[model samples]
Target: MKKTVLPTMLSFYAPDLREQIEALPEGTALIGISASGQAIAVDLDAEAPHVLVCTSSGGGSTTVLRSLTAQFLHQGAHALVLDPKRISHLWAKGLPTATHRGNVAGIHDALVGLGEELARRLDLADSELDAAPRLIVSVDSALAALRQLTRYWETFRSKDDPHTSPAVAALEAALWTGRAARVHVILDGTPAPGVLGAAPHELFGTVILARVTASTWQRLAPFTGPAPKPSRHSSRGHVIQQGESHETQAIWMTDADVVTWLTDPDDPQS
Candidate 1:
């Protein structure tokens, strides 16, 4: 079956981070601008809370992450960023609502913190209390981070211990329990089967593909049939969610815009 090819560039009114934040409804995050100029958003309090974003180098995935993180903070959510590369997420550091982890150990610790938070929320649920504030765990180059985590486990864990690695266990625990506690995780990297264990799809409600190859598309979105032809000139990409697919122009933000969003109280000019 011939796959649908998205236009090289989808023309739409792409809103900056501040504009998107102002337009967001409570509990929803503006992800990007749809082809029809509508804001594409996901509900943080409902639906699956996990998001998997796949992109090649220079595919604008970082921009998506930045936009999403900003929106999460705009909604008074706490964002924990795990960036093993130590470079991509530098902008997120020092934000009051963000916890930035740049090393494997830091990532593991962050996951452990998330697990503890989940436990606390579960306890609150038992007490019939309201859900906790939303938590967004954004991991940049997640594939690399997972791999580094395994290495970290080999070095620190007992050779004879018979349990899942702490990093994986913590991550899986968050994936399993975070939805109920309003904790969302965003993973950005090339998709690799079994990298996060079986049924990785169970962790994510939405998947976004940017400048990926057919093989990567097959591994990530096989249900969509054949992969769309590669388009070198395209900044627009595809989003798959709840079995539906759409072409979207991922919102772009400049460094100045990000800083303004983080520091300034006034609305930024788009």
Candidate 2:
């Protein structure tokens, strides 16, 4: 009997995030690098519209997300970032494409507004669909935000509030019906059962796991086979979608990169 060893990070000739973004065609989702150094790009319009990134703190999740956000903005998409900690998304604060940014309270309002916008788009006929801009709602530390929202709800539950929890309702609405209206969500955090409703799998089309414990992986994706154990020293991660899994590297992005991306070439001060 031989002991089974899971795959770890291996050397590959993958290009960095900037190169991949430059090479990909407009409107394609840059899904990072495969173990064999292949660039994974998906057409969101034709495929799944939402992504959930699961990882512990300092697990390179933010790097992956910022890379995706930059690519989205470069390709003419509007972004709304929810950063309860107010640190993860500071780089996007003044960007022209960043329509919204702040703590959980702001997130709640933004989602509600987005829901209304989604409704407006849904009401439009097919000929008017081209006027809609692709919307990306990026939530950093989603689990933390959900926990905070829960705490707030508990504090106010005794008052007999008439309206539904705005945060949860907006999130649920986006998860349920925003796909067809060109609205997509990107959540980066640990996956906790019952936090994002009974069945989170139905809400997200793709899941990315990075430097997480085996137990956590199993809990989130029990149907999949053994999760790949990437080397802690490397920037590798894994993506699961449609019953398939692939080893990948969450591309790294820096504050300088973000600043460069957001700065307008024509305006020296931008």
- Give lDDT per model, in order: 0.71, 0.69
TM-scores for all predictions: 0.85, 0.83
Model 1 agreement with the true structure over 1-270: per-residue lDDT tens digits: 234443454322242445445677766776665555555677766567788888887776777787777767766788898888888878777888888899888888888777887777777753453535678888888878888887887886786874566766777777777877777888888545555564545667788887788878877776887776544644467788776666676666555566566677464342
In model 2, the clashing pairs are none
lDDT of 2 by residue, 160-261 (tens): 664456676677667667766777888887655554564556766678887788877776666787767655744557777775677776565566666675
- Report the CA-based lDDT of candidate 2 relative to the real structure: 0.69
Which lDDT value does model 1 have at 2? 36
Off by over 4 Å in 1: 1-20, 126-131, 160-163, 190-195, 233-235, 267-270
